[model samples]
Target: MRKPRRPDVTTLELVGGAEALELELHSYDERWASSYLEHRRRISDTPMAGKIEIQHIGSTSVPGLAAKPIIDIVVTVDDITAEEDYLDALVDAGYELRVREPRHRLVRTPARDVHVHLFEHDDPAVDDYILLRDHLRSDAEDRSLYENTKRRLLSKRWDDMNDYADAKTDVIAAIKARARAARGR
Candidate 1:
């Protein structure tokens, strides 16, 4: 018998169809922080006690970074493959599971505004996200470059949200490499 191939976790497929494909970028909003805090608090209050680390990540977390109004959050779980451990509690807390995979799980609020990424403890993507965010926040030149690149890409009609996100990979990678090098990692 042949073994089943494991699916790739890094590549995200297009979701939500054409109507959801509309990517709207907004000027930096002060409320983003509060929104994150609220979600964090809500999640923490759940039964998952001591099993999760919730963080406000992505473009929305960076002050002065223009981004889609959606709040992107990263929730580090004890195990990614064990969704049943916390999925029920999270759903009860108001997050609906959207994407379920071997490496991660994505959940969103009722309005589909806040995105929650669930990864296992010590996942490299967590560090990558934090590094990029911290780098962009502290380094003005790179921040400007990223913002400008995003602004330029925003005008193009993308087939889906994944396409829009994938389009920014090169710039993100370049910045991430510089960030990693600066840290001597």
Candidate 2:
């Protein structure tokens, strides 16, 4: 007998559409951070728990960073389709899958107003994000370094938010390398 086929987990695609990501600036606010946790709290109550590990990531999670003020949540799961068991729950909570990065096992929020980054545990992207987040939170000097870079970049006019994101890649990659060395990862 032949083995059963499974849904491919390595075909995740990026969120690329005409949809412009609003990369604006906002003063730090605890309320915004709290909302992220609050949203997770509600998510905990959803049926998605069996397949999802939700997280609050991105600049919004980093305190004192001038950001677009959107909450970035990382929902870790073994499989996005497996979470169909909780699809209704996510919808009830007002989250729609936007980006589909098949190669990376990720799905972003359909609406960027609140960035929901979905990923699987085995995915390197999840670990990379957590490592960077922890590295930034624990080291004030590094945080300042990142903030300075961001400020410098934000000062310039951009064609769109995508351009802004691409520009940060170089600095972020360098910082992540340092972060890995510091943590011995």
Candidate 3:
């Protein structure tokens, strides 16, 4: 791991107006699942995989949510702070470091539609994401509720994508808590 360069102007410019954009709803289709898995597999085969573990996550991975048509991949590494040399691999792989959200994780993308997350395993929030995704998969009621909320949100005008994501925090937190309690945590 080497020291990371300070984000260049392009990276800074890309992190613009974090608003919740309107969500586009699509029927629960096998294509989304298929595409997501295929993309995940392709990403995993990349050289980046030697340094990162990739997982398909987000609403699209949930199987039945009305979501934006982007496949989200969460990639975990040993230390994000140390991956300076590997950042170029992502760029060469056609990804843009859109958000340098050092607080949670440094999220990037090979494209705008799909987000490819980069995180250090030391970050607990990555675990949260994995757990929440697992919980949604296990609980049918939770899945239904998520789909309903997604439909309602998609029907509205959002300031940007962040607003829509922020709206789901309450329900997501509730479901996470329920899952933990049920597991006797």
- Model 1: weakest 10-residue lDDT segment is 1-10
> Judged by lDDT, which candidate is best?
1
Name the lDDT value of residue 68 in candidate 1. 88
Best by TM-score: 1
What would the per-residue lDDT of candidate 3 be over residues 1-185, giving only the tens digit for each residue?
Answer: 33343432323333655644545877656676787777677666666534567777877777665567877788777556545544666767667666665632444554566687776655667777878788887888988888788788677888767677889889889888987886778
lDDT of each: 0.82, 0.69, 0.68
Question: Which of candidates 1 and 3 reaches a greater lDDT?
Answer: 1
Clashing residue pairs, backbone N/CA/C < 3 A, model 1: none
Query: Residue 84 deviation, candidate 2, in Å?
Result: 2.4
Query: Which pairs clash inside model 3?
Result: 19-160, 19-161, 19-162, 20-160, 20-161, 20-162, 20-163, 21-160, 21-161, 95-110
Q: Tell me the alpha-carbon RMSD of every candidate.
A: 4.2, 4.0, 4.1
Clashing pairs in 2: 11-102, 11-103, 12-101, 12-102, 12-103, 13-100, 13-101, 13-102
Better of 1 and 3 by TM-score: 1
Query: Candidate 1 lDDT, tens digit per residue, 76-99?
Result: 877665566778889999888777
Alpha-carbon deviation at 172 in model 3, angstroms: 0.8
Estimate the TM-score for candidate 1.
0.88
